[model samples]
Target: MSDWKLFTDAACTEEFGGTLTTVHKTNFSDNPQDFVLYFANVAGDPGDNQVLELVEATQPGTNYLTMSIVDANVGSGHEADEITLATTAAGLDTAIAGASLDLGQDDDSIGVIRLLSGVSAAQEIHVRVENAVPNEGTSTELSSAMVEAISRTKSTA
Candidate 1:
């Protein structure tokens, strides 16, 4: 699969329940060239009010990266949810300048983004749940599991 794997954060508190996970190559192999980041809601009780964040370990200047997420779930709750991986509002807007993203629908959804070369290979990439209001438990588990699975796939591939 892929060399990347999930490394759980032990510093997360109840305010940030569950672990914030990062996916990276096992050995941080020769500057990851081409790869598409994918995330899906695999197993969890469906609900609304769920949000996920994609974060990258970054330095002041050297590295920059941008990507957008598109939900792939089917049916009503499967409405396309797109989010750009940016730390600033301006950056996010720039990243999704021409993309059409819908935030409507229940919390049960999956999204994926294509990683570009601007992102630093030395940085760790991951997703963070912003508000786990309605489905905190299930969201935490499912999201973590989804990331874990994807990282495993990359590692094994």
Candidate 2:
């Protein structure tokens, strides 16, 4: 049976803008798998126009999973939007702009993305939480960010 395995856990209270990448140790087989992210913003208020996105920070390029709002107080509301797993820079930018997650509130949200079939066994993978659109001087605090891996196992025919 396939099960979810804890890959990484991170928490921070500092205010940051732009992109933040956290590298974690993981053993991902070449088989199909999924990367699940559980994250929350406990304290502080992320501005109205702030957007949060969880991305796979690979060496050659980055893959975007979903986007959310950092502040619930924004007009957009708290909702996780799907982003196309495109490798191009313009495609990624457009995808991120279309989604938002409200992080100013106390509640948490999950974002899941499928790992590429060609993914090889690696010692570490980078997970990035980006605040693309921060409203002026406002900032948000990341209470916790957890990543879990779920792999599919094959059975002998």
Error of 1 at 152 (Å): 17
lDDT by residue for model 2 (50-82), tens: 122222334111223223334334444221221
Candidate lDDT scores, in order, read 0.25, 0.27
lDDT (tens digit, per residue) of candidate 1 on 92-123: 43444223322111212232321211112212
Stretches off by above 4 angstroms in model 1 are: 6-70, 87-90, 97-121, 124-157
Looking at model 1, which ten-residue stretch has the lowest summed lDDT? 148-157
Candidate 2, TM-score vs. the true structure?
0.24
> After TM-score superposition, what is the CA distance of residue 16 in candidate 1 from its true location, in Å?
14
Model 1 reaches what TM-score against the true structure?
0.24
lDDT value for model 1: 0.25
Instruction: Tell me the lDDT of model 1 at 40.
Output: 26
